[model samples]
Target: MAVTGGLIYRGIWKSSKRFGPFPKLAVAGILGFAVGKASYVGTCRNKFQQLGLEGGPGSGPWSRRGPSGRGHRSCHHVFEDCKKKDQVAPAGEA
Candidate 1:
């Protein structure tokens, strides 16, 4: 990751010398961050789909039991719900 970031920084620094150093650095940082985030999300979605967590036609066990009868849910929606559930205190413990 550090190597990738350094490459991005170097490329941006050389290509946009007209811009101030800080601006070039900022653009490279934002671009790197965005790329990293997108890669992570895509990987997670693919893994979930492979595991049948994102329910659909070939979704193993979850295909028949999805909240929607159609058996479909976005990876983002599923993960956000999981996060929300985890943050809440369970049952009478609270």
Candidate 2:
């Protein structure tokens, strides 16, 4: 992103000559990184919410972790849990 921004500033933006290219390049790189990180976090949050695994503290994915913090279940496990919760027996059945 910094490289691209530098190229654009040097090659196109004639008005940017006063402040030079470094500032624009730096701004572009920082903005790009921040936007990318935010996008990734948002995507994960949406996916977890959709899977009903983001209810927070005692119910969110983090709740499944072990004392060593290495027992986290994969998405498959969460999906299976969802399926089980959604299954229903007939009215006459228990």
Candidate 3:
């Protein structure tokens, strides 16, 4: 990122000379990296269900870490307990 920024900085520094500085562009490049990593983690989660973990936008995916660092469960191991508890929670909670 820094290298890219340096190249971009040199390429645009002269044009931006009138402004205070081109730091904002460099900051944007850095923030882009963080956004890239977060999206990557989400993409890697596609195997969550296959790993015996839940696969949804809500609670199911948050509660199933196995003893080993990696999760391992049959594909059918849905969150039966979570579903039961979910039924009794406030209507807005589901």
For residues 22-49, could you state the per-residue lDDT of candidate 2 as single tens digits? 6667777889999999889867777767
In terms of lDDT, model 1 sits at 0.57
Number of the top-ranking candidate, with lDDT as the measure: 2
| For every candidate, C-alpha RMSD to the true structure in Å | 13.8, 10.4, 11.1
Residue 89 error for model 1, in Å?
34
Candidate 1's TM-score = 0.37
Per-model C-alpha lDDT, please? 0.57, 0.58, 0.55
Off by over 4 Å in 1: 1-20, 55-66, 69-94
C-alpha RMSD (angstroms) for model 2: 10.4
After superposing candidate 3 on the true structure, give the runs of residues whose Cα lies further than 4 Å from its correct spot.
8-11, 14-22, 56-94
lDDT (tens digit, per residue) of candidate 1 on 51-86 = 656543455544544454333453336566655665
Ranking by lDDT: 2, 1, 3
- The residue-by-residue lDDT of candidate 3 on 1-94, one tens digit each, is 5654566668753335565345656666778888998888776677664565444333343446432222533344647765676677777532
Per-residue lDDT value at 19 in model 3: 53
Best model number under TM-score = 2
